[model samples]
Target: MRILIVHNLLWAHYKASVFQALQHLVDQQPDLSIRVLQIARNERSRASLETATDADTPTYTYQYELLFDRFLEDISLTERAQALLRHARAYKPDVINLTGYYDPAQLLLLAWAKLNGIRVVMQNESTAADHQRSGWKELFKRSVFRACDGFFCFGSQSADYLIQLGVPPAKILLRKNAVDNEALRAVYEQTLPNRTRLQQSLHLQTNNFVFVGRLIEVKNLPMLLNAFAEALKRSVNALNWGLILLGDGDQWAELSQQIGSLKLTDRVTLLPGRPWFRVPEVLALSNVLVLPSRSEPWGLVVNEAMVCGLPVIVSERCGCVQDLVHPDETGFVFDPEEPDKLTQLMVKFMDDLVDTQRMAYYAQQYIAPYAPDVVAQEMLDGFREITN
Candidate 1:
């Protein structure tokens, strides 16, 4: 089978699970010939063109003059339609998989694939209406769904949403996002012995919890910070616990100001975003992982943290919370907006008397089935069904 992957690739940062799954599929199936075509704006042309490919894989890239200053004006329909038509003719792929949010390129590719009798698989972070509010945008997005052969959603909610958008239920595949288990295992094996040393180096006490993701309003960081502060105040051993925040975003200044006003500067540490490769090391050094997002399509990082053998506390709003977390089994789920609820879960998680090693063991066991290889095989099976 010859497959082509069309998606946006910026800064050579393809840490997304979909990309990892595609790469894993290519590596495992000898009979599958895979190629990736990255679409970038004119400004990213130099960097995108200069990217080097691994010698072991068959890959190619194409760049065009699509440019826009803001998110809403990124690409015009005609330009994207033309690009999709050109790339489809040039690559002549048997199966085309498109990943990303709703965009002109995605819609055009789906329509062109339908016209050409090519198998089209559309994978998005989540449902269209869940992310966008405009009526026109929802209508446009529904049209895009009509053109694809199959739809792959990162969670069951997303699949249900697609069905609500008029997509046939049978055409939607519910495949949870996964982790690169091999990379995670390698990093864990190398860093497991240095956990205590790394924690000490960072000045984190044994009870510190870690939060990783862009520090933004949608992530509900302010609520989380408040809940953490409340939890610390309620605990008798408040002096021993702290919170470590990873990643930066537009909400940094506001969050910093709130933390300062609340006198939480000493209890919270803000770390800048690290490369994707170093994330496992960071996860291993932390005692627990917390994701408090107001609305999350699927929290891929939750899966990654669980695979790294770290207990997680995610909000019920996050789609991945249902698939990855089994309340009090592998991790706990709370309402992100409710500080009291989150604080209660945090307090319970911290006070649990069970062996930490056993908790980590359970976390690993729960997440192992969603490894990249297994997810990729499922994706391949979906593609086969679509193509046949």
Candidate 2:
């Protein structure tokens, strides 16, 4: 059995870890072969997330091919489609796993695979709450979902969306998203000793609620800032806590202005987005992770935070909230629209209402099941079930 997996970006370390494990599993099967076709090295919006990985040029050792040695946006749709079709025809795969429905090229490949009687597994991350669902897009996605033989999703929320879009529950192969937990844990543990010094050097408070991602409007940064300010006002241990925004985006100027107006300029610090590997360094100095996005698909940063032994305060809208967060046990989930709810949750941490150390332990324990090895095993099983 020859399997071709089409992916959009090559710089995703989490996906790379899963693929590496999948490749290892496939290697044990003498008659099975799996290869990935990465459309581009990285997306433009996520260029800052790229880090200086180890000796491996691709960051992970996996059997894969790169369609273009550039970002997908730089290439035209025609170019992408032609290259994908050319590669698909050459590989002549019996089964194909498509990245998602957004990419026209991959959708075209899905169509071709169906016409050629090839099995197709669709991977999706979008949730019903992530954005305003369009009737036309839903109609198109329903058609695509109906045509695919199996589905892999980010989490329960994504799987639920697929089911709502007309996919059968049995066909929902996997509903897990993960990071390279071991790698992240190692990096965080190694940097643990320097965390205090690093925080001092950066003038960060003893306890910080860190938000790491682009400063895009969809991230709901303004609301996060407002909630953090309120939390600080309500904080009894005022000297130790602060908010750290570890990303740069188009909203920098606006966010800066809001920080000043809220009188949180001293309490809030804005840092540029760093590479993926170096994230552990930031995570080491932080007490908690906060993702207050109005629209988040899966929020992989939550996984990263949990792997680093930090409890997360995630928005209810994030796809991972249901699967990863345990409502004040692992961490708290708040409605993004209710800034006051976020404020109260943050206050729980600041006022010593919740045991941070215990919650961190719980987070690590809860996240164990979402490891790449586990997800890869599910993927392998899904492939076997569909092909059989």
Instruction: Give the total clashing residue pairs for model 2.
Output: 0
lDDT per residue (tens digit) for residues 91-124 in model 2 = 9998899998888888899889999999999999
Model 1 per-residue lDDT tens digits across residues 288-341: 899988788888788778878888888887878667888767888887657899
Over 4 Å off in model 1, which ranges? 10-32, 41-80, 127-136, 353-355
RMSD of 1: 4.8
Q: What does the lDDT read for residue 182 in candidate 1?
A: 65
Clashes of each: 0, 0
Q: Per-model C-alpha lDDT, please?
A: 0.72, 0.90
Q: Which pairs clash in model 2?
A: none
- Cα RMSD (angstroms) for every candidate in the order listed: 4.8, 1.6
Question: Which of the numbered candidates is closest to the native, going by highest lDDT?
Answer: 2
Evaluate model 2: give its lDDT. 0.90
Report clash pairs, candidate 1. Answer: none
